[model samples]
Target: MNKHSITLSFEINEPQLLLRDAIKHYGISKKALTSIKYEGGTILVNGEEKTVRHILTVGDKVTIIFPEEKSSEGLIAEKGDFPILFEDEHILIFSKEAGLSTIPSREHPHGTVANFVAGYFAESGLSSTVHIVTRLDKDTSGVICVAKHRHAHHLLSEMQKAGTISREYEAIVHGFIQQDSFVIDAPIGRKDGSIIERLISQEGKYAKTSVQVLNRFHLQGEELTHVRLQLHTGRTHQIRVHMMSIGHPLIGDDLYGGSQKFISRQALHARELNLKHPFSGETLKIISPFPKDMKDIIPTKTTK
Candidate 1:
């Protein structure tokens, strides 16, 4: 039993069920179950050790003790500034600002959301790896999630693959989209010569996006449309690519042929995230309002 082991307790409500059945009902992943079986983890009934095959009856108190993570390595915990939206022992959510990359890359070796989180964890005296569940592009400000440990990351990744994690983005595009709503079903692949740009192609991975226009405006003699988009598949630059394919690239998204006059970065913000808690099975909905730089694009009473 490590010092940071997680304990999950469940009260049996059914008449007769196996411990495994209860665990399944609780939405624990099979990979986690295997880890519990072999990684010094334990299952108990009331106070005694029990196996998954143990018969559970009404009011039986079942407990699972998960192994603790090993200490994180090779990370430089330099201090950074960001707002934490939600945090617990196993997870952290932050409102990352535009111009900040989610993780360190060759070009951005420091000053990323990961580095900021590393600094935060160091300040809090916690030893854990940076386990990001959702990633936002540099210049795309919004709500981002990170797991404090590897187990929570694994569970959240499973949820994402199952389409249980939902993300909504608000974007201001170049044109006034005539359709109130539409869906973009396209395959995306890296451009033939460019390493960073993604484009629609026949040989690419399948992707889908749903869009609904929120408001239309004529600002500074240019037409701009505020829209809400939902991603069915998480691909690199899915929204920008899809919108560009439809001749309405996001304002300030230079890579996608958008004009850079409105803002220095993409006129896109991750508006909301809906998902189940990795451990508690509770539904969590996190939101970030539209960034101030984008609000001027919206029509006011005078513009209307």
Candidate 2:
């Protein structure tokens, strides 16, 4: 057996049904079934090879061996330092530092989190491709989720679509917000003629962000507020755009009209993530502490 191949065995408990039906009842997807049939996978009943049409009965043992996975070309493995928050056979969660891209792009074709993960998989002898469940911006630091296999990826994607996965972020905005808590309901669309900029527009898709003031302080005579934000929609630059729309752009977010006199990049961090396990159905809460640069901005008791 390949070390990376996932094998699941189940003892049938229901009445007579086709093996395919049993597999579907167990949450196996149609695409996975097709892969099992066409790819180098195997299905067995009572320790003997069987097809999907085989009749399944109570007390029958069904075993499924998933196909081997291969990393895509150009995803060169490169080792780097990354903090692991949680890991299991089905999932891997890690804290990503600011200034590192989550995945490679044409401009940045290497040295990303994906490349490092590929290297980790190779060193660990896991024959799996990189499947990022939650992606953060290149300049955003926070916890990110990754699936270990195609099946896990599919299940987690479903969870994301169903709105079962949630995230919380902390940021320092330019101006102090008077309101303690509020929601920004706006539409976000790409700025005209810019592939990287997003703005509030009437023709854009709906985006909502819940904001709460965590603390208020003055830095070098400039008013600033620390806020917690939760996204109801995952639009590109949603938080940055929404904060700017409310007249409190994140500090150092120059693209969104924030000043960069104090910090080099946006003062945003993915603080927490809440989701149910794809396989175990248990709630998982992962947290990342404030990075040194973000923490330094907060004033001490005497300064506040």
Candidate 2 wrongly placed segments (more than 4 Å): 302-304
Kindly list the per-residue Cα lDDT of model 2 for residues 72-116, writing each as its tens digit: 567889898899999999999999999999999898889899999
Candidate 1 is scored at a TM of 0.88
Per-candidate TM equals 0.88, 0.94
**Any runs in candidate 1 off by more than 4 Å, and if so which?**
1-3, 12-40, 50-60, 302-304
Q: After superposition, how far is residue 218 of candidate 2 from its true place, in Å?
A: 0.9
Model 1, 9-110: lDDT tens digits are 889999889999999887677888888889778889997899899999999999888866544566667799887788888889878889998888776678
